[model samples]
Every structure is written in C-alpha cells, then in structure tokens.
Target: MTNAEQPETPLDAVRALRAEFGIDAGRVDQIGRLLTGGDFRTVEEVVSLTGTSRRTVEAVFRALEPDLESSGDGRRVQEGRAAEYRCLFGAREPFGVRDPWTDDARRDPAAVAAMAGLIGAAPPPVQALDHVPATAETVVKRARFMLDGFDLTGAHVLFVGDHDLTSLGLFVAGGAPGLRASVVDVDERLLEFVGAEAARRGWDVRCHFADLRLGLPAALRESCELVFTDPPYTPEGVQLFVARGLQGLRDHRNGRVLLAYGFGERQPALGLAVQKALNPLHLAYEAMLPGFNRYAGAQAVGGAAALYVLRPTRRTAGAARAAADDTRTAMYTHGAQSVEASGGLDAQAAARVLELGADAGEKTLLVGDGWPADAPGRRIALPAFLGAPLPRNLQDHGTALVNLYPGFGASAVRALLAANAHRVGLVCRNDLPLLKDAEGQREFAGLVAPKFRIVRRLRDTPGPGQALVLAERAEPEGDAERVLGYMYARAHGKLGNAWREGLIAARKAAGTTLTKSEGRRAIEASASRPDLLERSLMELPLYLFAVLEGDVRRSVDALPG
Candidate 1:
C-alpha cells in the first residue's frame, strides 16, 4: 500500500478539494462524503447530513458544477462518476456530524428560522448585562442538544439568566411533552416579554424576577432537574450564575447544567480562570463542544462560544449549599457592575440619603456596596438586597438608605415594595429614568403607591448626579386602599392568602359583616383568577400585579353589601 499504488487517494483528494474550493478541510470532507452517497441530494439534504451551512453546501456544488449531473430539487454525481467521487471521501465521518434532535432540524426548517425571527423581534441586547444574542443556529442547536441528551419529558429546567430567550427556543424546536421551564432575570423588559410570549404560546414557562447576584427565590430553589446559563464572561460572572444554577437543582445527583462561555483565543488565561473557578464548584466536565455557540455580537471571541455540559460530583453538595447562601455581585465586564468596578453612590450623597431617612433610626439598612464606612446599621450588597425572600434585616428596617444609582429604578421599586421599612431614602442620579419626567414619575409612583407615600426630598440635590427620594409607609386611605394596602404589605407572601385576609378586613371596615368563609366564597365565585394567588408578588410582573389587584378588588366589590 505505497503512496504510488493509491495515487491521488482520499487524503490527496481532500487536500485538493480544500485548496480548489477554498473551504476548510473539515467542511470539504463533510460535504464530499455526503455528495457521493450514491443518491440524489438537495443542498439542504447535504447540509442536514454534514451539519454545514447552506452557503457552504452551495459553494461545494459550484466547485463541482462541471462534473455533476443536476436535476430539479436534487443533484448527484454524473452517471459513471459516482464511484470516482465516492472514493475521494475519507473513511471516517467528518467532525460536524451530530444526531439531529428532531426531523424538524431539517424537515421543518421554518420553525428554526421562526425562532431567529422571534429573537430578532424581541428586545435588543442590553450591554450593561453583557447580553450578546446567540445566533439562531446556536439556539436551535442548544435545543437539539437538550432533547437529544436528556429526557426533557416531565423534566424541570431553570434558566438562571435567560436574556438569550432559550426558554422559547426549547418550545419552538422541541416536543418534550411535559417540559417545565422557568426563567429568572433582572431585566424586567425581558421578563415581561417572555411572560407575555410564553402565555401566547401556551407554554409552561414561568418567569421570576431576581438579580442573581443576591439570591434565588425560595420557590425556585431546589426545583429544577436541569439548569442552563449563558452568563457574562468573567470569573465572578461564571461562578455566580453557575452557583445560582446549582441552587436551582432539585437533586444534585440527578441534575446537570449547561454553561456557555467564550474568550479570545489569545486569552486562554481568562478562559482558564473561569474553568478554574469551576473546580470549587466540584462539577465534572461531562463534555465541551468548542465553537458550538455562534453569537451575533462579542466579536473579540470570534463571535463564538463553547457549550459545556456539566454534572455535579459527589462532593458538590457542601460547596453548592454555600453557594445557595452566597451573595457576590461583581459579574459583568463593563459598567459599574463589572468585575473591576467599585464605589457605590457618592459618600456625601449617601450621608444625605441617611439624613433624609433619619427617622428610620439605627435599624436602617443599606442595600448596595461601596457606601462610606460607618454610614449604616446593616448593609446589604446591591445584589443581595434584590435577592428574592430578602435578608430578614430588610423585612424589619426602620429607615433604609438605598443606593439606586445608575438608573436601577425597576429593581429599586421591587426591592422597596417587599421591604417593610417605615421610610426609604433612595439615592440615584437626578436624571433617573423613573424620576426624570412627570409621566415616568407618575407611573413609577403608581407601582409603589400601595406601600409608600413617596416624596422628592432633595430634588436636584447637587453633586454627582444625585437626588433624594423620601418614601414613608402610607396608611390605607379608603376601604379600597385598605384592601390594596393589606395585600401590598404581604407582597412577599402567597397572594391568595393575602387577598383573602385583605378582603375580609376591608369589608369589615366598611361596616359589612362578612365571615372568613364568606370572603373565600366571594373570591371563588368572582372573576378572580385563582392561579394568581399561587405566585409571589415579588416574582409577578407589574402588569400581572395590576391583574391581581383588579381581581382582588373585583372580588371584594362583588361581596354581598
């Protein structure tokens, strides 16, 4: 078997094809094998078999145009040339071959395209969060991997941060009958979008709002069988997201996590640091698929990401338990939240914030980091304050000094509503989006109206784009306000329980005697959506919150007067 005996063999042909077609040797090998398979094939069929893009297949056909016989919708090697071309292929399958997740990957290509369109139409990526949308192909491939690798039937998944919208991707590409998915994100726009879209699709996807730097909600912890995350590409970012993912697992022994990460090829040290961080996590690298993820942004990493399949080791439990209670916030690569960035709201402004909230006393808490030393009683890191089921200290604060600088209005709103502080002094840029205009202020004010009587304490306060917001707990004004306030006060509790008590108490205030059982009956018989009761107010979207309010108020009004 000398080289001369098998002159211009498959290896030589592969090289020749690579040179002549200007395609990579790997792609040349993939398309070469599929083209000479002794059957007519369309461009898509070849793509399906080879896992190459449509353009790559078309280029192959163009390079082989003179030798091939073409016909409608399919083409093949010319009559007697099949054997000649077939012998040019390598003995082994090429690198890109993968078991398709479903016939839909090829047979129903539009569904895949539709997924891309949906992501495009949704909100654009927010740079502050390190959001770079994954390519549609990557998203489809992810769903394929999910369905192909695990039994998603009746499986529970927690998407630790789903700005990628992988939750919808699963529904679009997979047919897992009982797949249960949940998404926890700090982005309200994304959460609201996902919530509405999932509802429209009649999906079992539930969205919970939480900034992972703090903690996961009690309801979401230990509730999923699979956790997937594409976190910011920093060591702290990787660990924090993965830690929250770990916390979401129902049972460590049976659960798994998928992590997407990328770094410039020259920056192997950065990648290594992230991988090293995983050692403390005690996770086995079940698999690593290089360049498995293609992104629309993040060009420094060549617009690609690696997909890591991870499984927990026996010793993963103790460290995972610690992560469940851990609160570390430096995760991003840019903005004030980035790994190297620090220093919270300006110190003098912080003092002003405390001064404005002075009546709150020493029991007051500070929510964010970098506050001047000796400025507070109890201090919660920005991320921890936003954690669901907030630290106990937050529940009993007197006057809390909150640093909401850099326009974290939505998060501040959610955090304050859940806190039982008598008054909260909000520190933020004067031009804060939620307070910049009357309309913005009015809308934001309405969202928190049930809890706080917010007043602009030091409007346009000088120095470092700062302003002070003084929020004092509001007393229930009317029978309706009482019902709303009672329910709002228990925002962290189960909605139905709060609604039931609030209804009975408010009706009693109106001089209407109603038994607890009667109030329950009133709700059961009214237009109230009972399912809303099962959700925590802290997790519910503002729109959904209004719906809950409407349901409760309507249920109360319908009560026998």
Candidate 2:
C-alpha cells in the first residue's frame, strides 16, 4: 500500500491529539515513534523524552484520556486496550515457554544430588521470613526450567534474593557453561555460604550484601540480562523485590525478570492485590505457570506458587524511577520479624547484655540490646539478629559479643565476624565452670577453652543465667602478627571450612607430619570465636609459621609442639 493509502494509525491519532493539546512537537514525535513501533510509553519515558517530571507525564496521560489507557496503575499508559498490550518496547510472548521442568533436565542423578546437598548447606530458614524453602527436587526443576526457558547459557544472571539456592542449582546443573551468576542478599550467612560454595565449585559467581529497601548496589544496577527472585510472600515484598530485579536488568529492551509468587486459593484477593502491585512497575506479563514452584513445607499456599515471566517495557523504567524513593523497609509478611525490624532485647537478653557489656572499658559494645545501664565505655544497639543487615559500626568496634539466646545461632556468629571486631566473644547459658561431659566439653571448646581463655566464668549462686567470658587471645607479636594479618585479610576475615583446607595445604607444604585431622583441629581451635579478626589474632600466626618460615623443615619445627 502507498503512504497515501495507509489508514490513520494509533501513532497518527496520537500526533493529531498532541497538536490539539499543544504538547511539545518533539515529545509528541518521540511518543508517536515509540507507540507506532508497538511500544508502551511510560511516564518515565515521556519525562526523559521531554525532560519533565512525573506530574507532567500524568497530565499528558490524563489529557489523552480514553485515547491512551494507563496500565500498571498509570505508570504505563498505552494506546491500545490493556489486554492487547504486551511490553513497552513491543509485544512478544516469552520465547520457549514450557511446562515447569523438562524431563531431560530432571533426569540427571548427579545434578539432583548436588542440588540436594546445596539446599542442605543453605542457612536454616527464619520462621519470621515465612521461609519454607522448596524441596531439592523442586529447586532443581525450577533451575532447569528457568535456564531452558530463558536460554541463559553463558548469560550473566542476577539473583535479587537466593534463599532457595536456585542460582547454585544453575551452577550445579552444568549445562550452562560460562555462566556468571551473582547474588545480593541481606543475610550475611547466605552470602558466605554462596561465596564459599561457588569458590569450591569454581563457578563464576559473586555474592554481595544488600537490603533491597535501601536500593540496589550501584555496581549491579543495569548489569544483568536476567533477574530471578523468590521474594517474601507479601504484596509489598513482591513489588519491592520484583522492582529491584527489574532495575538490575542490563538491557531493558530485551532483559527479562523471572518472579515466583503465590497466594492461597482462599485468598484470591491477596493474589490479585499482588498482581495489581506490578502495575506500577509496568512489566509485560509474558506468561504465568501456576503452581510451578513446589515447596517442601509451605502449607499456607498448599506447598506451591506460580512462576511469572516478565519483560520490561519503557513504562517499567519510569515506574522504577518514581518508586525508587517511595519504597519502604518493611515489605515482608511479618512486619515485626522483617529484616528491617530493630532488634531490641527482652529481659533475659538484656541481663546477658549487662554481663557482656560489664567490661567494655574504653571499647565500643555493639549490642543487639540498647545501652545496658552502668555498662562500660559506649554502648550502641546493632541490628545483629537473623536476616538483619550487618551494622555499619561493626568495623569500628574493638570487641563484639552476642549473648547466646534462643533464636540466635550461626547467623549471629557470621555478623560478629563480618564486623571485623578485633576481639569477639559468645556468652553462653551453660555452666562453664563445672561442665564435664565430652559432648558438652566439645561444644564449649568450639567457643572458649582453646582459642579463647575464660576471662570471667561466674554463676551468682543460682542466678538466672550463667555468665562466662571468652575474650580473644592477645594479638600475635612481631613477625607472626604481621604475617597473620596478611593471611587473614587475604581470607576476607571469615574462617569457614575452606580455611581448614588451606591450613592443611600449608601444613603439607611445610613437610609437617601433621595429620589432616590435626590441621583441622588447629583451624577449628583458631576459629573458636569464628571472627576473622579474632581468628587472625589467635591462629594465623601458627598458619604463617607453617607456610612461610623460610625452610620447609624449619617451618614445621616452628609450629608450637
């Protein structure tokens, strides 16, 4: 057909309306070209094109009225009916859409086993998170399906949240070569676990610590082709995480976001509310596979949730810009238990705080509980509980201690170590002065007796809780301290199981007759407090003496008998 014969199109109509409304000709031209190309022009796009604020974009849409319908709660206003619209860039169904997991992907026994192991190694789920991680089989299926459906071979994938270990499953499945996977999470334990496992497997994976509510890391913004997230099962949580994932898309034109969200049948309204929340983000809903994710223990949703494949439109970009400053910290199912919750101490936790804070003398005590009365030096409350971001003051403190209490474990330990405290201690409840059982002794040895000395062990004659002190051993002196600092810094301040292997390697290289078990014991003894600074002060000296003492035999001789 000749240009003259061409019918007045949506773009032509937009142009006519633009002239009638006296909108900027250049802005109208930009909008016409984009919409004619079958794209959604969001408030963000119009603002960027015309150099205006969101209010102006809203005014333009309102002026257009029925001619251009606003989608995603008005963030994305399009020329056609909402049902006919796909994405801001163009309309395209998700390529290679398939049932959850292909048979071939699920048949690999080794991959399945590896998935199980990874899931087992993940940090224990926080009940407050409503975290019932999917079964290993479910996780393997989800990974396989996502990789295949998304064609993620050799792609740089970003995981906004990874409690399910889907990213690890992708690495283990092994079909996607040269895959560069990265994770950003508030949980330090998850970051540590993923980092160690990735290093062990030699996969190109990097772990970062971030709180989504605070915005994404600047380095990761617009840096990935795909983003996968299984956000908290709340409308606010879903929108925040999904929006963050969308922001991480390197190229919004072709980038995709895979979202896992589910609501109970009885709570259809809740599910609808969640779906509606996506309107502001302006993601093109490509396809949704209901009950695609199967959890092992989430009875609230009948152990399953749907998977959503979303492609970003220009509207998505605009929504992200507008919502960036509007997002809040409490976007979880349990507001009080959310990672943003300020950890305040109860009476028992407070009592232990007094004991831990009693000898702070000229040192900062970053306690989970606020300022203990008569506490020495300065006392500050830190959000050191499960899922909370590590306090910024951790690096400033000389000594850090967490009074062992219910609902606190390795996660707390990880936070203390990450703080870079020079000395770290774990105050316990058991009577350390009279403990004798081998099993009991082993647990205490893991914390105090060996690497840490009993600075104070007291029970005020049937007091409410036992008070036992385990301070960091004095820093190494001379060459030993220098070498120790170098090695610990190289290890990044956390002594995980990998450090044990490294210690064993150092021992063998020194020609030491140290058994692997002995080397393991030494590493464990050095890690009693598990704080990098604490471990360096105590064990790195011995490690350096074994590895760097000039002559191999001399190095072996140098290790304490």
RMSD values, in order shown: 8.0, 16.7
Clashing pairs in 1: 214-383, 360-399
Model 1 agreement with the true structure over 135-222: per-residue lDDT tens digits: 6767777887887788889988899898878888888885498888899998888988988898888888888887776677767888
lDDT of 2 by residue, 1-561 (tens): 477844365434444545644523443434433434445566555444433334434544654454564455333435354333222224332212356374655688788788888888788986655667876766777777766777776788999888988888887776486678878776656777886788787777767666565566555678899999999977778888888887788889988898988765446798898888788898889989876777765555656678899989878887976666454545665534364564434555555655554354536554444335654544433332222334564445566665433223222223333334456655443443224345744444343222233354444311344333345643433433333333433332333443444455554555655556764455544432232322221122121223332322232234455
The lDDT of model 2 is: 0.57
- Residue 240 Cα positional deviation in candidate 1, in Å, after optimal superposition: 0.7
Best by lDDT: 1
Highest TM-score, which number? 1
TM-score of each: 0.78, 0.50
Which residue pairs clash in candidate 2?
A: 40-88, 72-279
Q: Alpha carbon lDDT of residue 372, candidate 2?
A: 52
lDDT score of residue 381 within candidate 2: 35
